[model samples]
Target: MSTGPGILAPVTALGAATLRLLGEMGAMFLFLADGLRLIFASPKQIPKILNQVFVIGSKSLFVILLIGVFTGMVLGLQGYYTLVKFGSEGLLGAAVALSLIRELGPVLTAIMVTGRAGSSMAAEIGVMRITDQIDALDVMDINPMAYLVSPRIAASLISFPLLTAVFDVVGILGGYVTGVTLLGINEGVYFYRIQTSVEMADITGGFMKSLLFAVIVATVSCYQGYFTHMRRDGVGPEGVSNSTTSAVVLSCVFVLVADYALTSFLL
Candidate 1:
């Protein structure tokens, strides 16, 4: 007859698991619906979308450039040493180009964006949630999802590819400098090798991955922030903090997973 504790334990565990799964599913559906709406309602918000794209894409150029340069330099230095041991120093350009275009560019850019812009987006939305601004938008007959979330998703879609291209170009320049100037590789030979080695497939693969990463980052950040309960009786500062942390961690994990999946399928 004293089965109260055992029964209560299982019931509580099930209830908690159910609630967590429901919350995650709800957030995912909201994000999907938001993305679909943006895709269908495109022409109306072109200007706003463009503004966001510019802000998201252009504002990130400096950091991407810096990372690209360093990445290229390091690649060249490392590749050169490795190839020299095998008398294959001429493959330096191809090595750098392949590495940058295939892996490092997308992954590094995503990590940086997730850490910088993603965190910012989550924090900003968290603040709005806590302040009831999102609710006020609903009361004013404005679709908060359309107004707040769509622009970001659109901006990310447009910005990520551009950022990837920038990363590619800057990284190549970095490799060129280190290889030609420091390693004494002939400039013409280095450029020619890169031109021949890198193909459209590599470029396309990187861009596709970047686009997916952008979507993942934007969606995760928005979801975390939007679902964050800041009410007095619900999620408070601690919850918001957890949301922000989870957003970054989840975005990173998805980026890496997506990268591998895309690479496998594409290549």
Candidate 2:
């Protein structure tokens, strides 16, 4: 009898949600532009940027190594068995190297760093917002965006590529250990295939993905934290927690989505 109102209710909710998402996305892009624009506003920012690099890059090194090795080993094991069916186990090296360098290296590095550093960014900024520390910086004309967000953005840009390189190298070695040393595949063939099959284009494409992911993770993480106080779902400590959770989740989702988009273009 009242189907009109029922249907309209769901439609209105969906429309409102879509509008809100679009608004938030617009705001986030502006936030990223502003943060990047102010990255070099002062020479004194050098130390801050370096500090963030250490935080986001050096600190995450061990986890990246551990994950990279295991992933490569798994790839080697699987690729060997799969290729052996066709008597092409020698291609294992090429398969693992290409997979890690062109895809997994950038994607996994970004996701891991996002988990470690992105969440921290959101939590730290969210805490600052809730505690009025950000306000104090504004009162002092310190430019909170420049002071807090820009360094992080700069650091992510620096860190993501380097970490991806490390992941690729370590993953290749791991694959070597499994495919050649343990699996008894020809070491020369393994390395030769990797060298011959992987091109400069693939390497550059992976770096490009890392750079884009760096921007996405940094901007989304900082934006979530900066606007924590404005969240409708929570406030104060709860708001900080929600912001941190949202930052990690959104960064990962954005990373994967960006990865697919980049792959399509690069391929």
In model 2, where do residues sit more than 4 Å from their true spots?
Answer: 1-3
Q: Best candidate per TM-score, number?
A: 2
lDDT of 1 at 252: 100
Task: Count steric clashes of candidate 1.
Answer: 0
lDDT (10s digit) by residue, model 1, range 155-213 = 88888888888898899899988998999988888888889999999988899899899
TM-score of each: 0.88, 0.98
lDDT by residue (44-147, candidate 2, tens digit) is: 89999999999999999999999999999999999999999999998999999999999999999999999999999999999999999999999998999999
Question: Ten residues in a row with the worst lDDT in model 2?
Answer: 1-10
Give lDDT for model 1.
0.85
lDDT of 1 at 167: 91
Provide the lowest-lDDT 10-residue window in model 1: 230-239
